[model samples]
Target: MALDRRWPLALFRGAVPVALGLLLWVAVTGGEQERQQTLKGRRAADLTHERRHNELLMAALREAAETEDNVAHRPVPWRK
Candidate 1:
């Protein structure tokens, strides 16, 4: 009878800490997920800005190349 009565109390005591620990774990994981999402958004914005800059640079380079080709094909004054 004494052992049976003690078993319920012991089980309750053990379950309380386990339940609290699980709750704390969930809170920590949720915080980490929020931080990761914020970082991902910032990184995506940075990449978009970089892509736009690269496209502008590529256009400028193409224009310069065309100008260089035209200059090279011109007749030299001495040759004329």
Candidate 2:
């Protein structure tokens, strides 16, 4: 009687590693997405802060420009 030697062991031999690899892939993808979301949130906060700082600097510059214009338009006391 010839023993059938390629059924139960051969089918499972290839399937187990493929199944384990798929599980590992799913876990790694989920972790990477979570990390990307965290970085995006931090980037958004940093941009908001930078915009506020730029606005403050613009207001100070405007005030200085107005002061300079006022001084330039004033009459010279020694000549008048």
Candidate 3:
């Protein structure tokens, strides 16, 4: 008799796994939606100071590289 009635028990046992999987899926998607909303509310690099800062950094790097090249390939003052 027990062997013949196993199908119902198998179905009942499966219910918890299905519910947990759905719950995890909903939680992950809900968190992602909240994160997207937060990101949309604030724009990076939208302020004036940020652009000027980046421009200054690029100019400094360019000047440094030019100086290095000029000094590196110049004849050693006493070698030639």
lDDT per residue, candidate 1, 1-80, as tens digits? 35678888999999999999999999888789789999999999999999999997787567767764554455675131
Give the 10-residue window scoring lowest on summed lDDT in candidate 3. Answer: 71-80
Q: After superposition, how far is residue 47 of candidate 1 from its true place, in Å?
A: 1.5
Q: How many residue pairs clash in each candidate?
A: 0, 0, 0
| Of candidates 3 and 1, the better by TM-score | 3
Better of 2 and 3 by lDDT: 2
Runs off by more than 4 Å, candidate 3: 1-3, 41-50, 61-80
List the candidate 2 regions with Cα displacement exceeding 4 Å.
1-30, 69-80
lDDT of 2 by residue, 5-68 (tens): 8877987998999999999999889789789999999999999999999997787567767764
| C-alpha RMSD (angstroms) for model 1 | 9.4
Positional deviation of residue 68's Cα in model 3 after best superposition, in angstroms: 11
Error of 2 at 57 (Å): 0.7
Residue clash pairs of candidate 2: none
How close is every model to the real structure, measured as TM-score? 0.45, 0.47, 0.50
lDDT against the true structure, per candidate, is: 0.81, 0.81, 0.73
Best by lDDT: 1
Alpha carbon lDDT at 8, candidate 2:
73
Q: Tell me the deviation in Å of residue 22 in model 1.
A: 14
